[model samples]
Target: MTISPPLHLFEAFGVELEYMIVDAETLDVLPISDRLLHSEDDLPVSEVEHGDMAWSNELTHHVIEIKTNGPHPTLAPLATRFRNQIRQINSQLLSHNALLLPTAMHPWMNPERELHLWPYDYSPVYTAFHRVFNCNGHGWANLQSMHLNFPFADDEEFGKLHAAIRLILPLLPAIAASSPWCDGQKTGYLDSRLNSYVPNSRKVPSVTGDVIPEQAYTQEEYHRKILEPMYREIEPFDPDGLLQHEFLNARGVIARFDRNAIEIRLIDVQESPLSDIAIASLVTATLQRLVNESCTSISQQKEMEVASLRTILDQTIQDGERSVITDRNYLRQFGISEPQVTAQEVWCKLFEDSRKQISASHPDAIPSIELILKEGPLARRMLNALSEAPSIEELRTLFRSLAECLAEGRAFHGL
Candidate 1:
């Protein structure tokens, strides 16, 4: 039988919100969103919830993401629809003097009390997911994310698609990296959401298959290749975090993308659309450039490619700008055998080299690098305002201000 290509790419667009909810009393984390808001008229995330209480996202998408189900084309229109959903939700939250700050990590979250209980109900999938994925009852992620997926044609196009995937993966934290506090105190990490999701997402080893690892790989291939094998009816709460691994594995590539593009799973919920747009645009443009005929793919790259990608990504979660340098410089600073580098220089050079690489491979992609170099990472700006805040409330207020500016279409720096 002749096989036809699957709509694996066909392009999709989606948005997820990673919120850091403040408790009514401690501002630690009430962890409430549309889920806890009790009202008959509260907006609905999808038809999944229909009840007197305010329900959304089936405990994941709304609280996890603010997405629109569509077969839309082009980032422009998709952005419009995505923005509308965000605005609508913002309008609801405004009734309470509250604002949405898209970020990855939150501090002192008491997920124990903060139930994912929606108005109508959480399905079997969520019930199973929440049990473990929402472990320790201290749920921490309350931010925003954007995803885009492109269709894979044949193996060749898969290479291109995978390149886009690889290019975007390391750059994920750079795009979102909003979380800076844990348990109300600054945890010194920008994207704490990674901490939150790893329990829920990563930690799974992509299965080793019958076919040995290939010498060369593509982003699309990585997506399909590095998945954990399916096991019979795995449950969360297994003594081993392996259950969590299984859960994450079962999710697979498009599992989350039931709606949009390759989901940019790393960002925290931003306060507004402009923030989303700027980061998204930069990431999208970078990915676009990276996937061009010249950009490298994860599997089929030169030596040190994997390590460079891993180090850049792993460190960016906390201090995309600084932590990474610290991580890379761990030895050098201690006078130990090092990679012959400093962390800051490592980060600067990583992207600097990428800039040169892109410039050489595809000159058109150089502008995105220029923009980041000019603007600096969002974490720096977040840290400065936080330092100025005399109180937690003030810091929250600063967060609100940034979100508002980003929402109002202000320039990133102007905000």
Candidate 2:
């Protein structure tokens, strides 16, 4: 299944959004994804196709993933088609008293009891994961994310794209943190999904290089530094050699040289598909300007040290937009001069510059940019709404509001 290439930089991209199936009334995670897939009347649940949209199963039975067929030139049509699929899926699940919720983690569901693997098609790979790493852990069984795939047609494009992604990977959590609660309690980290995800894969140390990727200037370098280490580490465990490909990189941002693309895996799933598309547009447009204009280089002075970058990521995951950017050296790279700045300030400047560059061609994304600037990211909004829910009944009330906004395709304001 080869996807078509994009004509210009940032002009085209693909999206994949993961969502959880939960009971309509109690809102508990429901492992009925397989049953729901076949429950639809007109189509085969294994792989449903509607024009460019594709629906499929994931590692767990409570989760499903929806992806666009190929690179979309515009997000308007993409969001419309995606929302239509969500509506259709929700309608089908209603017969079984369940619905899909857009979130990185279920607020109160216990993954230990609810975790279920897809029994058909590629079950061997999933079985390996379950046996090797105990996939029932919080990182594997309970998290969801939004994946963006951007094309890099050649070696030059891959080099430039890889550099740009590494520079901005740490700050993504500040703008997309949606997992605030886990196991019926506050996890303290705003993007708890990522915090858990990093350590969860550490059992297989070669699989991930933590949140930010190590610098790789060429495909050969990436293959040697990132891919080879992982393959070597897993070879001893899987004598059959199941996990031998580039998919093992597992870094926050990875280069798929085979597909000639770079996949960004840092962003959490937002409340609605529109917001998710909006964030994708913002990131794509920003990277376009950075690479085309040569605004910055991957030099020593311009880059943050690996240690400092990891520390910042940890702080942002805990504090979200409120995290302070106190490193004046790093702040200068983004053109921030304040003695101290918040994560919101960094995103505000990026969005403003990106809007100017993208507005003439793709104006539909402006509202989403403005919404984040004004209302804060989805994570901040969720935290504020959760504050108002003082009791279990009130929490349910707030969640219902959020689920409704997700289903209705609207921005979620505080309850």
Local distance difference test values of all predictions, in order:
0.44, 0.78
Off by over 4 Å in 1: 1-12, 15-64, 77-81, 94-98, 137-144, 199-225, 228-247, 250-261, 295-299, 302-308, 322-372, 388-390, 406-415
| Model 2 stretches with alpha carbons more than 4 Å out | 1-8, 36-46, 298-305, 388-391
Best candidate (score: TM-score): 2
How much is 382 displaced in model 1, in angstroms? 1.3
On residues 342-374, what C-alpha lDDT tens digit does candidate 1 reach at each position? Answer: 334433444553555444534533443344445
The digit string of per-residue lDDT tens for model 2 on 1-415 reads 9966544445678899999998999888888877655535633256666688888888898888889877776765677777888898899898999988877888877777888888777678888878778887788899899999888767677777777777677788887888887877778888989988888777778787766777776888888878888888888777777777877667788787776778898899988888888888788877776676444554533255656677778888888888898877666656667888888888898887777765876577688778876767777777777663345666667678878878898777653
Q: TM-score per candidate, in order?
A: 0.66, 0.93
Cα-based RMSD of candidate 2: 2.6
Clash-forming residue pairs, model 2: none
Candidate 2 has what TM-score? 0.93
Number of the top-ranking candidate, with lDDT as the measure: 2
